[model samples]
Target: MSKANRTLKKIKHQGGRIVPHLILITYMVIALFPILLILINSFKNRASIFNSPFSLPNAETFSLVGFETVFGRADFERYFLNSSIVTLASLLFTLLIGAAAAYALTEYKFKGSTFLSIYMAIGIMIPIRLGTVGILQLMVRFGLVNQLLSLILVYVAMNLPMTIFILSNFFQQVPVELKSAARLDGASEYQIFGLVIPLVRPALGAIGIFTMIPIWNDLWFPLILAPGTKTATITLGVQQFLGQFVSDWNAVLASLTMAMVPILILYLFFSKQMVRSITAGAIK
Candidate 1:
């Protein structure tokens, strides 16, 4: 090819790559804007929050009153602990059971396996919230009402279907030779499953972040199942600042800002793996 034609082709290739990155950056900015606003306003006084909602905290506007109120009026530490416990515990159980189930369905040949897979997939289609009444009754009967365990159990059940679906697809993509090699090396079934899990780390990261966000931010389940002060998740605990006639915007914003910390950490931790997974899928 001529130098001019070669240069044109190179430019075209670079533009193709740049365009997607531009789109992604635009989307990221759009998504993070609200969170940015919350964090900025959380540091400002109430008057400044209302007067210049989008502006950053300045010398005159900056105040710690919101943080003060939040810490003073509520046991935010306990709420944070409760939410962390429930969210992490739910993710742990969901991943374990879902991964095991997916491995069984994909790797094993058994009776009713197809039917069982279909039955599990049904959970993905039907919103778990639709069965709230029944779940509440079951929890009540089990004497788990107002308990963090109730939230953990419910969240695990809620997230399992999607987890299984995603993990099963990833598991299917695992090279047969890898598993065969493990078997040839005298690896037991459980050991082979362990070997497969690390290969699907990206999928696990994606599932962990996906499953965690809802469970952490969920107010409905926390409100219904574990509304007690001692068991309240951060999302529900923040509701205390919202009153019938008035709301403490400062404390509310501060609490929300603080509540977002774990999510940011999780995203930062798992973002690389998720990007790798997406890029890998796109390449294929």
Candidate 2:
């Protein structure tokens, strides 16, 4: 090849690599900007927060009054515990049942299997909030109103459709020979399903993060079915700081900042798997 042609090709290759990284960096900055703003202002006094919302906290403006108020006026510990319980429980059941259902629909050729899959997919298209009235009534009939279990059940149901949809695609991609080998080794159906779970860990991580975020951040279901102070999730608990006429900006920001901690931790924990999934999809 001519030197000029080779040089042009090298530049194109380098540009292809550099462009994606630059775009990713830009996207991250855009996404994190609001969270950063909230964190900075959460440490500032209320007046300073309003006066300089985007500025970093300085010695003059910095105060822990917001944090203090958040902890003082609310059962922060209980709210955190309730949210943890509901979110984790919902994720656990959603992944387990969704994985099982996906495996069956993909591996087994049973009657009505196609219809069942379609029925579940329909949930993904329709917003769960549209059935709020019916769900609330069902909760009331079951005497599960104002209970954490209600939130768990509702979240699991809400997330299951998408979970099944994603996991089904991944499960279908599992090599048939692997399952046949497991069978030859006398692995029961349950054992074979268990064996496939690790192979799809990336998909699980992606779905877990996607599913947990909505549940953790949800306020509508909690408000309708489990609004009791003892059962309030962090999102619902944060509402105490928001008043019609006199809102505590400092406390509200502080509470929001604190509420972000769990989601951030989970994202960090599952980030590797998510990256692997995304990279694999890109390669394919």
Candidate 3:
């Protein structure tokens, strides 16, 4: 609390902002450096990629042969559809069920509510793959193995816990007065939820992004539950292709870049919503 010490502290605080950018610059390079390398080399022929690793590709040396080969070898269209179908479907169910559960946990006071919340939340930390022994057995018994439905069901169950926890946290932050007032005006429980969840649509946006990303990127459930050659997801397909064509640098890089593009596009488009959602629920 001395004046000289206070001034020194102020200088330290002032320096902190500038200091972070150094770290940021370093981390950014660390993060995007590989991506930058991949993108630059992707356009080059193999010899140029190896010879001039850091140089950007130029028109003279650039080629699209890798992409052509990847497209030529696989049913790329089917793989894309399989991934989209599974990711979209799983995301839809996770959001719907998770939101409803989160709302109930926050809005209602009932017996066993805490226990039920805990029970559902166990999935957040425990990988559902542990239960695959049973799940696969059941799937086999039900004849669901190698089916898209199996992937969807496993993903939904795996993702539900965290989604519910996030939505519930946000639901609790919603002004209780809003719900009471809605009820005062004759809103039913269903109507209250419908009206109120939208108010926190920002949180839902965050939840949707969070839920969708993992399912889209997941290789395990798709590999285990539905690993037929014909039904491979984009992630699984790309990985398989890389293994099969390890020496085909062009095809390998193209597949990686292709997989990276969709996620990058989604994040760019939704970054505002994602950033807002993260900040909105943060406790000061």
Cα lDDT of all candidates, in order?
A: 0.88, 0.88, 0.86
lDDT assessment of candidate 2: 0.88
Global fold similarity of model 3 (TM-score): 0.87
Task: State the TM-score for model 1.
Answer: 0.81
Q: What's model 2's lDDT at 66?
A: 81
CA displacement after TM-score superposition, residue 171 of candidate 3 (Å): 2.3
TM-scores of the models, in the given order? 0.81, 0.82, 0.87
Q: After superposition, how far is residue 126 of candidate 3 from its true place, in Å?
A: 1.8
Which residue pairs collide, candidate 1?
none
Better of 2 and 3 by TM-score: 3
Q: State the local distance difference test value for candidate 1.
A: 0.88
Off by over 4 Å in 1: 1-34, 50-55, 278-284
Which 10 residues in a row give candidate 1 its minimum summed lDDT?
A: 238-247
Give residue 30's lDDT in candidate 1 (0 to 100): 97
- Report residue 203 deviation for candidate 2 (angstroms): 1.2
Query: What does candidate 3's lDDT look like per residue over 182-225, in tens digits?
Result: 88999999999899878767777778788788888889888888
RMSD, one per candidate, in order: 4.5, 4.2, 3.9
Cα lDDT, model 3, residue 64: 82
Candidate order (TM-score): 3, 2, 1
Q: What is the lDDT, from 0 to 100, of the residue 225 in candidate 3?
A: 83
